[model samples]
Target: MSSTANISTRTPDQLGASRAKAADNSTGKTPGPHRSKHRRLWWTTLAVGVVAVIVNVPWFNALIVSFKSDGDISRGALALGHPTTDHYANSLGAAGYDFPRFFLNSGMIALGAVALVLLIAVPSTYAAIRLGFGGRFIMNASSALRLLPAIFFAVPYFLLMSNLGLLDTVPGLILANTFLNLPLAIILLGAGFRDVPIELEEAAQVDGASTYRILYSVLLPILAPTLVAVSVLVFIFSWNDYLFALVLSSSNATPITLGAANFVTSTGIRWGDISAATVLSTLPPVLFAVFAQRFLVSGLSAGAVKG
Candidate 1:
């Protein structure tokens, strides 16, 4: 009788709240780790999205303006109300700009630079890392060189090229780009070389494999992805280089980077034409990156994990 009186004294709301609490306890599904992890993931995604937006907004705007006409652009609105290909046409050839020639020149020089960089960097990195042939000093020196401004070597390089009669030539640009790209290539290749195990070479040697043979058969295969990554990177760097091209190249060796400057004249800045050229210039590297991103990601990942 006393228990019945006590239960009757409680309100319906109180009884319902008590029953819900009992149900929750029975399930044993509390929100601590799961909820916090989800919250962190959400914040991380939001941050990445914001950063991407901020970085790409200018490029996106440029892309939109590239498709608009000169008259439309003059109106000062960012809309592509009347899209036209005149800018692209002008960039390609309609306005006396031999962009295709510039493209070919840049491609040749970039490829040449990549070839030269790999030729020297690969063997030197192997010797330094595997043979301990002054690896530390080489790495330190390369890092120091990378830190210095490119302009520091401008005059010296210019005089050297002039003496060699290499100024305003394709070979001149190739050598210049090679010098510019070498240090970073060495650093990157060194990292990749370090990721490779010495035991593989030793094992090959036990089977009477020469050092060259072992490097060719064993190490090169493992380093293939890294090589591709380095090649793509060096290609892009060589392709986009403007300062050296400006100082070294003339009509015979002029790259698209230098070619794009033609759009700027006393008549005024050709915003539409320049933007179109910029878009064209950006395509090769973008395509290379997209195609080789798998190798690049894997190579960098491998280098990051030393063991």
Candidate 2:
């Protein structure tokens, strides 16, 4: 069917009706279908807004109570009060919570894991996408491996780390994190690399630029945002890991996710302090999500189209 209401090929009576419809549209009377669509759009937008607020209620409550005193938290999770910095201090180890140490350990593992994942993934993904040597199989295998249960791999990694005397150490945690998250990094970073026009690579080759030089000087600049997005995702994964950290670490390499449990000991739950710790722990991932959101969006959108 045509979009125009004025169909010249219609019968005389049909043309009269079409002319009346076109006049109605021009005069803004339009039709019921368009009005119904507008109503549906407004209703959907309102429903989405309500759902978003509902989903974020808990986070808002946590933020509110994190600033309250131990006594004041009992008032309510959403209750407002003049806040104090005491919980922040205690959460950061002012009262011997060891958050600083936990932060250091988490940072070491997260940053190291991101570095290792990218180091292995970048060139490999680039080659897989561009070089075309069993690229399809490589992608399929990585995806399959990613879907396997963590325990399947963790058992072997545990034994290996134990034999290497790396258990309860930063490097051990980093290794575990990198191993678990590497496939995802490859799939994501490769998407950005895949989007890079092959003509650029060929042009560089024609100019006598080596593969490594082209990758470093030409591709790296284009991939900076993608790199940041990948790094942030990997960092969040490593930072928020509870299972691998719990299974692999003892006292030597406790991260914030595990260390946060200290507040729930037999001494009774320190709700205020826990809330504070939770709030602080939320910052890194949130900051990274905010900063790299554009690149992440672009990467995902491109991945959808290209893949």
Listed in order, each prediction's TM-score against the native is: 0.79, 0.81
RMSD of 1: 14.0
Worst 10 residues of 2 by lDDT: 1-10
TM-score of 2: 0.81
Model 2 residue pairs with clashes:
none
> For each candidate, C-alpha RMSD in Å?
14.0, 8.9
What local lDDT does model 2 show for residue 225? Answer: 73
Q: What lDDT would each prediction earn against the true structure?
A: 0.80, 0.79
In model 1, the runs with Cα more than 4 Å from the true position are: 1-47, 132-135, 294-307
Instruction: Please report the candidate that would top TM-score against the real structure.
Output: 2
Candidate 2 local Cα displacement, residue 121, angstroms: 1.0
> Against the true structure, candidate 1 has what lDDT?
0.80
Could you give candidate 1's per-residue lDDT for residues 1-307 as a string of tens digits?
A: 1112233234665654565556556656655544654665688789999998998787777788888988889988655577898988888889886787898999999999999999998988888988888859988787778779999888998899999999999999999999988887778788777777778788899999987787788888888867887788779889999899888887889999888775465368888888888888888887875676665555445333421
The top-ranked prediction according to lDDT is 1
58-172 in candidate 2: lDDT tens per residue? 7777777778887788776656678877888888878887778888999999999999999998888888888885668877777777778998867888799999999999999
